[model samples]
Target: MSVDEVAALSLTEVAHKIAAKELSAVEVTEASLQRIERHNEALNCIANVNAEDALAQAQKADERLAKGGPVGPLHGVPLAHKDMYYRAGRVSACGSKIRADYVPDITSTALKKLDAAGALEVARLQMVEFATGPTGHNEMAGTPRNPWNTDHITGGSSSGSGSAVAGRMVYGALGSDTGGSIRIPAYCNGLVGMKATYGRVSRYGAMPLSFSLDHVGPLCRTVRDCAVFTQVIAGNDPDDPTTSREPVGDYLADIEGGVSGLRLGVPTNHFFDDVDDEVREAIQESISIYEKLGAEIVEVEVPGIKHGFALGEVLGRVEAATYHSTWLRERPEDYGTQTRNRLMQGFYYPGTRYIEALNLRGQLLSGFTDEVFSVADILIAPSVPMAVPTIADTDISANQGFLDMIARFGSCTRPFNFLGLPALGVPCGFTGNGLPTGYQIVGRSFDEATLFRAARAFERETGCTENAPVL
Candidate 1:
C-alpha cells in the first residue's frame, strides 16, 4: 500500500492488515514516520520522534508475527502519545520546560500495557505545559497547530495527540484528561476521545495535574479505534491503588449493537447556556440523528450541575497546587506564563474550600445520576460550547478575553471530570468557520461500553468519522 493508503487506515484496520500480512509492520511504521517527518514541521505536534527505536521495534514485531506465535490485538501498530507518559530511562517532558530533561525509572502502566499489546511508540507529542491549559498554548515548547486550519487552536492539553491523530500522522495516541484535556482537543480536531471514569485506568508513572480529576484515555480517528485502544490500556493495575477493581468490559463486543431503545438525555441546563448557535445547531442535528437510530431523546434536568465546574476548579487547583508546590517555590522561572499563573491559584485555595469541594463530589454525583441517569441511559452535550478559535485569539496573555475563552473551552468537559463519569467526545459536524465541533456523551461510572455503543451508533448513522483534516 502507498504511504497515504497506510496513513488513511484506522488503527484497528491497520492492526488487522498487519496481522493478516497484507502490510508488514515495518511498512506501516515507515509510513507513520514519513507523515510525521513531512507534517510535524508545519503542525508542531511532535515533541520528539523516536525514529530509530520505533523502526527497530517494528522489525521485531514483524519477526514475531512471522514466527506465528499468539499476536496481540494491537500487533504492529504505531502510536504517539502526549509527552507525559513515562517510559523507564526515557524523558517525559509533560509539556513543561521544567520536566524537559526529567527521566523516570518507572514506565507508565498504560505504555507498558500498550507495549505488551504490540503497539510501537513512534513519537512523543506536544501538550500544554504541565497539562494545565485548555488552549494548547505551550510557550516553552511551541504550541501545536490544528491540522484542519493551521492558524486555529487544537483544544488541549492533549493538543499534539489530537493534532497527530487527526492529521493522520499516527494511528492513535494516548491523551490524559483533567478538565477536558482529551475531549477539547478531540472536539477541535474532529476525532473521538474518551475520558474514562476516574479509576477505570491506572495513572501510575503518568504526570499528574490533579490527583482527583486526572484520567488517562485515548484520542483516535474513530469510535471503534478508540474503543480498542481503551480496551488495551484499561483495567486494574497493581501499582496504582486508585485503579478500580471493577472488571473491564469488552468495549467493542457490542459497539455495533446500535442505540435501539436507549434513552439519550439532552440537558435543559448548563450544557447549552453560552453555546454558539452553530455548535448548538450541530448538536441538535446529532440528537435528531440519534432519534432516527431508534434511540429516544429525552430532555432531562441535571440537578446540581451548575456547581460542578467551580467545585472541580477548587479540587483540581488544590491538587495541582499541592503537586507543584515545590516547583512553584523553586525553578518557577522555568514554567510558562499561563501554566505558572494557573498553578499559582491552586495555592491560594483554602484547605476548607478544597475539602468542601471533595466532599460535594459524591453528593453531587449521586444526585446527578439519580435524577438524570435514572431518566436517561446517557447524557449528550456539546464537547465544546463554541467554534474552534484561532491560535492568535487564544494565545495566553494578560487579557481578560483569553481567560474567558479558556474557561469556555472547559465549561462542557470539566464537569464530567469532577463528577468522575465516563465521557466520550465524537465528531458531530463542522462549524460555520469550517472548523470541527463535536458532542460528548456521558455515562455512569465504569459504563464506557454504553457510551461506545451510543457513539458508534451515531458514527454509523452519520458517517461523521469519515471526515479528516486535509493535512
Candidate 2:
C-alpha cells in the first residue's frame, strides 16, 4: 500500500494486512514517521518522536511474521502515546515544565500492554500542563492545533492524542481522563474516546492529576478500533492493585449487535442545560437514529448529577494538590499559569469539605444506579456543551472566560468520572458551523462492552465514523 493508503487504514485493517503478509511492519512504521514529520511542525502534536526505536521494533515484528511465529492481535501496528504516560527511560513531562527533565524508571502499564500487543510507539503527543485544563493551550510545550481547523483548540490533556489520530498521523493513541480529558478532545477532533470505569484500566506509571477520578483509555477513529485497543490494555495488573480482578470481556465479539431493545436514557435536566443549540440538536438527532434502530429512549433523571461535578472538583483538586505538593511548594514558578492556579486552589478547600465530598460519592453512586439505571441501560448526553473554540478565544490567565469555558465544556463529562462509570464519546453529527459534535454514551460500571456496542451501532447507522477534519 502507498503511504497515503497505509496512513488512512484503520488499526484493525492494518493488523489484518500485516497478518496476511500483504504489508510489512516497517512500511507502516516508516509511513507514520514520515507523516508525523510532515505535519508535526504545523500541528505541534508530537512532543517526542522515537523513530529509531520504532523502526527496530517494526523490523522485529516483520521477522516474527516471516517465521510464522504466533503474534499478538495488533501485530505491527504503529501507535503513539500521550506524553504524560511514562516509558521508563523517556521523560514524561505531563505537559508541565517542572517535569520536563524528570524521567521514570518504569513504563506505564497501558504502554506495556500496547507494546505487548505488537504496537510500535512512534511518538508521544503533547497535552495540557499537568492535564489540568480542558483547552489544549500549553505555554511551555505549545498548543496542539485541531486538525479540523488550524485556529481551533484541540481540547485538553489528551489534546495531541485526538489531533494525531484525527489527522491520521497514527492509527491510535492512549489518553488519560481525569474530568473529560479523553472525551473532550475525542469529540472536538472527530474521534472515539472511551473513559473506562476508573479502575478498569490500570493507572500505574501514568501521571495522575486525581487518583480517584483518573482513567486511561484509547482515542481512535472508530468504535471498533477503540475496542481493539481497549481489549489489549484492560485487565488486572499486579502492579496496580486498583485494577479489578474481574475478567475482561470479549469487547469485539458481537459488537455489531444492533441497538434494538436497548434502553438509552436521556438526562433532561443537568446535561441538556447550557448546551449549544447545534450540539443539542445533534444529540437529539442521534437519539432519534438509535430509536429508529429499535432502541428505547426514556427520559430519566440522574440524581445528584450536578452534585457529582462539585464533588469531583473537590476530590480532584485535593488529590492533585497532594501529588504536586512538594513541587508546588519548592518550585512554584516552574509550573504554568493555569496548572499553578488550579492546584493552588486546593489549598483553600477545607479538610472537612474534602472529606464531605468523598463521603457524598457513595450516596451519589447509589442514587445514580437506583434511579437512572432503573429506567435505562445507558445514559446519553452531549460530550461538550459547545463546539470547539478558537485558541485565541480563550483566556488562559485563569480569568472568568477561562473558568466559565472549563465549567461549560466539562459539565456533561465530569459527573461520569465521579460516578465511576464507563463513558464514551462518539462522533454523531456535524454542527452547522462544520465542526464535529459528539454524543456521550455512558454505561454501568465495567460495562464498556455495552457502551461500545451502542456506539458502534449508532456509528454504522449514521455513517459518521468515516468523517475526518478537512485538514
Candidate 3:
C-alpha cells in the first residue's frame, strides 16, 4: 500500500494487516511518524513525538511476528494518547506549565494494558491546560489547530487526540473525558470518541479533572476502531478502586448486530436550545439514517438534564479546585489565563453547595436514567449544540462571550458526565459551514455494547466514517 494509504488506515485495519504479515509494524509506524512530521507542525497536536523509540518498538514487533507465536489483537497498531497518561521516567506535561517538567515514577495502568496488547505509543498529544477548558486553547503548550479547518477549534481537553487522529497522524488515541473532553473533540474533528461508562475504564494514571466525572476511552476513525481499542483499554484494574468489576463485553462480537427495532430517544428538551440550524439538520439526517437501518427513533422528554449540567459544573469546579488549591495558592502564575480563571471560580463555591451537588447526584442520575432509559434504549443528542467555532471566535482572552461559548460547547455533553453514563460521539455529517459535526449516543451505565452497536449501525449506513481532512 502507498504511504498515504498506510497512514490513513483505520486502527482495526492497521492491526489486522500487521498481524496478517501484509504490512510491517515498522512501515506503518514510520508512515504515521512521517505524516506527523509533515503535518504536526501545522496542526500543533503532538506535545512530544517519540519517533526514535516508536520505530525501535515497531521493529521488535516485526521480530515477534516473524517467530509465528500468537500475537496480541493490536500487535502493531500505532497510537498516541493525551499527555496526561503517565509513563514512568517520562514527562507527562499534561499541557500545563505547572506540570511541564514533572515526570512521574510510575506508568499508568491504561498504558500497561495497551503495552500488553502490543500497541505502539507514538507521541504525547496536547490538551487543555489541566484539562480545564472546553475549547482547544492552552497558553502553556499551544492550542491544537483543527485539521478540518485550521482556524476552527478542536474541542478539548483531548484537543490533540482529535486533531492527530483526524489528520491521520495516528490511527487512534486515548482521550479522557471530564465533561466533554473526549466527545466534543470527536464531534469537532469528525471522529469516533467514546466516554466509556464512568469507571468502565481505569483512571489510574491520568491527571484528575473531576474525580467523580472523568472517564477514559478511545478516539478513532470508526465505531469498530473505537470498539476494538476500548476493548483493550477497559476492564477492572486493581490500581483504580473505582473501576467496575463487571466483565467487559465482546465489543466486536455484536457490533454489527443491527439496531433494528431498537428505540433511540431524542431529548425533547435542553439539547437543541441554541443548536445551529445546520447542526440540527445534520443530526436529524443521522437519525433518519438510523430509521432506514430499521431503528425506531422516538422523541422523549429528559427532565432534570439542566440540573445535571449545573450540578456537573459545580462538582467539576470544586473537584478540580481541590486538586489545584495548592498550585493555585503557590504557582498561580503557571496556569494559562483561561485555565487559571476557570479553576479559580471553584474557590467561591460554598462547601455546602459542593456537598449538595454530590448528595444530589444519585437522585439526578435516577431522574435522568429513569425518564430517558425507561422510554428508549439510548439517548441521542448533538455532541456540540452549535456550529464548530473558529479558534479565533472562541478565544477566551479576546472573545467577549467566553462563558457563553464554553456553555454552548459543553451543554449537551456535561449532563452524561454527571450521570456517569457512557456517551459516544460519532461523526454523522458536515455543517453548511463545511466544518464537521456529530451527535452523541449515550447509554445506561456499563451498557457500552448497545452504544457501540447503534454507532456501528449508523456508521455502516452513512459511510461518513471515510471522510478525512485534506491537510
Candidate 4:
C-alpha cells in the first residue's frame, strides 16, 4: 500500500497486515514519524517526539514477527500519549509551569497497557494547563492548531491528541477527559474519542485534575479503533482502587452489529439548547441517520442535568484546588492567568458546599439511571453546543472567557462523569466551514461495548470516519 493508504488504515487493519507479514512494524512506525515531522511544526500537536525509541521498539516487533512469537492485539501499531500521562524519565508537564520539568518514576496505567499490547509511543501530544481548559490554546506550550482549520481552536485539554489523530500523525493517542476534554476536541477535530466509564480505565500515574472525574481514554480516526485501544486499556488495576472489577467486553467483536432495534434516547432539553445552528442541523441529520438504521429515537427528559453540571463543577474545582493548593500559594505567579484564577476560585468553595455537591451527585446519578435508561439503551446528543471558536476569539489568556468556555463545554459532558457512564464522541458531520461536529453516545456504566458498536454504526452510515484534515 502507498504511504497515504497505509497511514489511513485503521489500527485493526494495520495489525492484520503486520500479522500477515504484509507490512513491517518498522515501516508503520517510520510512516507515522514522517507524518509527525511534516505536520508537527505547523500544528504544534506533538510536544515531544521519541523517534529513536519508537524505531527500536518497532525493530523488536519485527524480530518477534520473524520468530513467529505470539504478539498482543495491538502488536506493531504506532501510537502517541498525551503529554500529561506519565512515562518514566520523560518530562510530563501536565501543561503547567509548576511541573514543566517533572518526570515520574513510573508509567501511567494506560501507557503500561498500551505498551503491553505492543503499541510504540512515537511522541507526547500537547494538552491544556493541568488539563484544565477546553480550548487547545496553552500559553506555556504553544497552542495546538486545529488541523481542519489552523485558525480554529482544537478543543482541549487533550488538544494535541485530537489534532494529531485528525491530522493522521499517529493511528491513535491516549487522552484524559475530566470534563469533555477528550470529546470536545474529538468533535472539533473530526476524530472518535471515547471516555470509558469512570474507573473502567485506571488513572494511576496520570497527572490528576479531579480524582473523582478523571478518566483516561483513546482518540482515534475511527470508532472501532477507539474500541481496539480501549480493549487493551480497560481492566482492574492494583494501583488504582477505583478501577472496576467487571470484565472488559470484546469491543471489536461487536462493531459490525447494527444498532437495529436499539432504543436511543434523545435529550432535547439541556443538551440541544444553546447549540450553534450548524451543530443543531448536523445533530438532527445524525439522528435521522440513526432512525434510518432501524434504531428507535425517543425524546427523553433528564430532570437534574443542570444540577448535575453544578455539582460536578463544585467537586472538580474543590478537588483540583486540594491538589494544587501548595503550588498556588508558593508559585501562583508561575501559572497562566486562566489557570491561576480558576485555581484561586476553587479555594473559595466552602467545605459545606463540597460535601453538599458530593451528596447531590449521588442523588443525581440515581435519578439519571432511572430517568435516562427508562426509555432507551443509550443517551445521544451533540458533543459540544457549538463549533470550535477561533483561538483569537476564546480568550484563553483572559480569566472570564476561559472560564465561560469551560463551563459551556462541560455543561453537556460533566454530567456523565458524575454518573460514571461510558460516553463515546463520534464524528457526525461537518459545519459549513468544514470543521467537524460530533454526537455523543452515552451507555450505561461499564457498557462501553454498546456505545462503541452504536458509534461504529453511525460512523459507517455518515462516512465521517473517512474524512481527515489535509496537512
On lDDT, the candidate that comes out on top is: 1
Please give the clash total of every predicted structure, in order: 0, 0, 0, 0
Residue 421, candidate 1: Cα error in Å is 0.3
| Native-referenced Cα lDDT, model 2 | 0.90
Candidate 4 contains a number of clashing pairs equal to: 0
Reference-based TM-score, model 3? 0.98
What shift in Å separates residue 290 of candidate 3 from its native position after superposition? Answer: 1.2
Query: Model 2 off-target regions past 4 Å?
Result: none
* True-vs-predicted CA distance for residue 79, candidate 1, Å: 0.3
lDDT of 3 at 265: 94
**Per-residue lDDT tens digits of candidate 3, residues 225-336?**
9998899999999999999999998988899998999998998889988888898999888888888888888999888889989999999999999999999999988887
lDDT by residue (tens digit), candidate 2, 307-368? 99999999988999999999999999998888788888788899999999989998999999
Clashing pairs in 4: none
TM-score of 4: 0.98
lDDT of 1 at 175: 95
RMSD to the hidden true structure, all candidates: 0.8, 1.0, 1.1, 1.2
Candidate 1 stretches greater than 4 Å from native: none
lDDT (CA) per prediction: 0.93, 0.90, 0.90, 0.87
